[model samples]
Target chain A: MRLRNLGFVLLFVAGFAHADTAPFDLSDAEHIKAGHKRFNKTCAAYCHGFQGSGGRAPALNAPDGLPPEQMFTVITEGRRGAEVMPPWGTSFTPEQIWELIAYIQSLRSTAPAAP
Target chain B: MRLLESIRTSLLSLIATASLAATAAAPSIDQAGSADPTNWPQYHRSYNAWRYSPLEQIDKSNVKHLKVAWIHQPGNITHGLQATPIEIDGVLYYISADNNVWAIQADTGTTLWHYVPKLDPIVKEVFYGSASRGVTVGLGKVFLGTLDGRFIALDQKTGKALWSTQLTDQRNEAGALFSSPPQLAGNVLFGGTTGGDQPTIGKIFAVDAETGARLWTFEIPKDDLKSWPGESRKTAGSSAWMPGTYDPVSDTIYIGTSNAAPDYHPYSRLGNNLYSATVLALDPKTGKIKWHRQEVENDSWDFDSAYEALLLKRDGQDLLVHLNKGGFVYVLEKNTGKIQNVWRYAENLNWTDGIDKKTGKLINPVRPEVEKSKLLCPNLLGARSWNHGAYNPKTGLWYTHGMEVCNYITSAPEEPGPKPINALTLGLEEIRLTDPPGKKADGWFGAFDPITGAQKWKIRYDMPGLCSTLTTSTGLVFTGDMRGNLYAYDGDDGKTLWQFNAGSACRGGPISYSVNGKQYIVIPTGLGSHAPGFLAGAFPGIKDLPGGATLIAFTLE
Candidate 1:
């Protein structure tokens, strides 16, 4: 089952416990490369700027800006209302979204980008 | 024997004349756009691709007295309201964001029936946000193309499901959906598949309008092996995403096609990608290409030719006036796809050095190269957005919006991933919006001659007008801006006669129709799309713009 931050009333209907989030290995260059490729191919074209420098959407250039759990949840359960952002969970697996999140984190890190 | 031959020829000529007279007199009742002023029937309102209404009840003399008669709200407005509404007799029909259809009374804001489709969860993955350009109302049925690869028909009266046909294969990770309403020609219904920038093959198809059975499919990219070289053709992003109109005179359908896949990278797929960034005249019954004109070769700037192909007749010749996303407008001979005149609507274009006037060939294009970012004006959105332009027959001018913005683009060789990823397939290292050099970044609306491209008058807006433009026989034009201001302008001189705050930015096509002897002008208000993101670089205040869905109907008080 999936839960979304749709409304305050929906929260009263379902209560569940959360667990410690497993972080995506941002140090892995290959993983960050895959995420960068995905971001360049998809997000950069329309929503975000090139290399997450910021355009229409927020800039993901700062790795410490967002918590892992919050980022994971946001990607998993997308913001209910957005101009263009969609729930990645519908299209990607949890691990794949982490692959995406890790790449976003590497944008502000010392990890080298792919060719 | 010579006398007999001459007699036979004379008889044949007489019969041909009678047949031509009959065809001209017969009303095309089954046609989606029947050229009726009482109803806004099709996307272009009529097959001639003119969004002009003949109703002059509220002319320029009294347009200032226009007042909102009523407003209808279509809930679940995620991408806001972008689809053009259709009306017939006293009934109005429109589709909201999740493919929901609504039937409302034209005179009043009473909801007759509302339908919500059971869509696939994959609908959430549509890169352009599952937007149906609009719905088609004909033959007692309303037709809609959905994001989950289905084309459906609903009973016009009760809004009940009449028949459903799955068009696109949902299993493909590349994700192809229908963004335009199915256009009707005879007993056949045809529409183009969207997701033009995805790693999927694009096709336009014809289906039995009644039974919902597939009739014919024409691949937009031609033969994969012919235009595209090697495996690169596998993901050639060519689609006729926008609605194309039918030309009753030539018995042909005119539609513009989208750009090739991996839009910015010309290094991978060399040669002029046939049919990508092209305009095709098709036989609606068979989906056969009658003639085609490729507007751009190996389109490297993400510019597509898939906008409305407006049809007009001038100088004793039939012509098709098309505005390519690259900003150049091509005037083509109607019978054959020969270029007559090529002009431009964009004020700031640098992707090409110039256009050859005599041969109509693009001259010295500045192609985007790998690792090097070049400033290209009219980025993916082109000179104009998907919101259509209006051609007024009475005023003899074509009205459209033009953007004065550019983008810095670095080309990258992008390939389809091992699996269908969650995003688009653009071959770009980076793309960011920028102001056009030496001038302020602004959008302007203008009136021009369809054949000669002569400007009549123009009005500049702080930001681009994102909604469709509509003209009336009253010599007035209707358009809306991102700031939620709807203006009524003089169609001849481009003078603002009246203005109203629609409460939210208008996105859908503005249309005028009459019900029970009263004419009403309807405009959809809401704004949410990647367009605002593109404007943020030029118009910083755009981020705080209000967004909501409401259809405002206005009539002279």
Candidate 2:
């Protein structure tokens, strides 16, 4: 009975941990497409160049220095002293912001590898 | 019988004297339109805003021999120079991009005096962002509207402060500030504000030309709009950001009003936002609206129809020729808001099918219900920006610059916070996601016949033609482009007769004047501006553009 109770506790812990981890499918075509649309619609052309080249805003096609989580934070809350990059916490939802990060990551992978 | 005769003579004398006083108070339309050939006293070089000079010593035949006479380098200005220097009595007076007034010698390009306004840090940060277009000379003083909402008067000869009065509320939190030059009409100094980017309503202020006292104010109507529902009315913006044209004969001021606020989102401001993107004819002294014609209603695109309304007397009828951001040239009856005719000036206009001639309404296609992306031509940068077009009476043609571009724009949610980090207007976002990007945006400097709606002649360029034009009676047209090339075009055929690379983009209006029998053409050149930066992406060839402000004058060598 003690062993059975311990098994149940372990199962509960595993479920909680799984729930905490966001279920982001990096390889999913639909997820990537949604992100591409959002990024292109909101991010590109005005500040960023047509193909993520530098403009009034910086280039984002190259590899990002920050990790996915940090980028998510930056896109969601925006960094202090950065007036140009407005906080998208209210402009976009959490899922959409995460998707944008995934799209940005895809841009890096799709870009020609550095010489 | 003797007493009665004396009384009647006194009454007749009084009547005659009053008539003389009224006539002297205001210069006739003919006098204002064609000022002394040596003086560019007003913003457009005249009250008619024709931007055409009669000095023709450097005619089509001699224009090829033009060479740089002198270069006035205004070092401290960190932005582009937009001033078309007003030459008065051999002295050239203008303002810098940052609202610093400079009085210089018209002959030698020597800086006589520079007056910089001392403003609080907050005011400087919020209000004075764009370039000052030009300055006004009137009532023995040079009038300059500052970014801190003050209309200041300076001694025309000494550049010393005469009087300074606040035109806007000192506690302005929504960033309403002056962007254009002030116009002196009769005894009043007229100017308008530019705060469409912020949450403020646009207003035009009339200040006393002599004392700099606020005389009358005209606020753009925001209430009782059936289109914009409730709260959006508060954010309605119809800023008169350009110096208007005046007709003393009609006793009317033709002021062009800018787009509505929160530029992109139309759901927030629903109704045909009246007077936001309209041309208003007003009484200069009383601020009463005589008539108004809105060019673009419920402006979703940032198409401000606030360019100078070129007033022309066509076939004995007062006709106002206006080119709007949406790429449409509207010919209206100047006295009445009657649309005489309309034509598509730009080649790639797709935002509307056509204009309803009877109602003066844009025939815009039905917007998608779900707010998907819609492709439109002549994007927010506009087919024609703030660059002034010159009308040549001799050639009977209008010389202007035009752009060809399209935008895939989608509506986003209105920005939530009052002071978002990116305080840019929200709702519509331009997307570059369209497959097979349409032809790269190109530019054209062309002469169009307003009556026929036809392009008579044009010189095409890979880089966008982004500058004002000046036409002279000598059959030579002067214009500049984003690539820093100023061209003297043959006014008849639009052929580039001579070109000079000014080492910077020439965005300011070109003016011509003769000082001591030497005809000189002044072109303001500077590299810094959003138009050039965006065009750099559109045209890959424009690179290594030099920075700083320069006023280059040319004369026949």
Worst lDDT 10-window in candidate 2 chain B: B429-438
Per-residue lDDT tens digits for candidate 2, residues B363-454, read 96434122677776776778887888888878888899988876666766554545322234535544432221456677888888865578
The docking category that best describes candidate 2 is incorrect
Candidate 2 residue B224 C-alpha distance from true site, Å:
1.3
Q: Report DockQ per prediction, comma-separated.
A: 0.36, 0.10
TM-scores, each model vs. reference:
0.89, 0.82
In model 1, the number of clashes is: 1
What DockQ does predicted model 1 obtain? 0.36
The residue ranges of model 1 lying beyond 4 angstroms of the native Cα positions read A1-19, A22-37, A50-66, A90-115, B1-23, B26-35, B224-226, B357-359, B419-421
TM-score of predicted structure 2: 0.82
Worst 10 residues of 1 chain B by lDDT: B25-34
Model-by-model lDDT, in order? 0.78, 0.72
lDDT score at residue B130, model 2, on the 0-100 scale? 39
Candidate 2 interface RMSD, angstroms, 1 decimal: 6.3
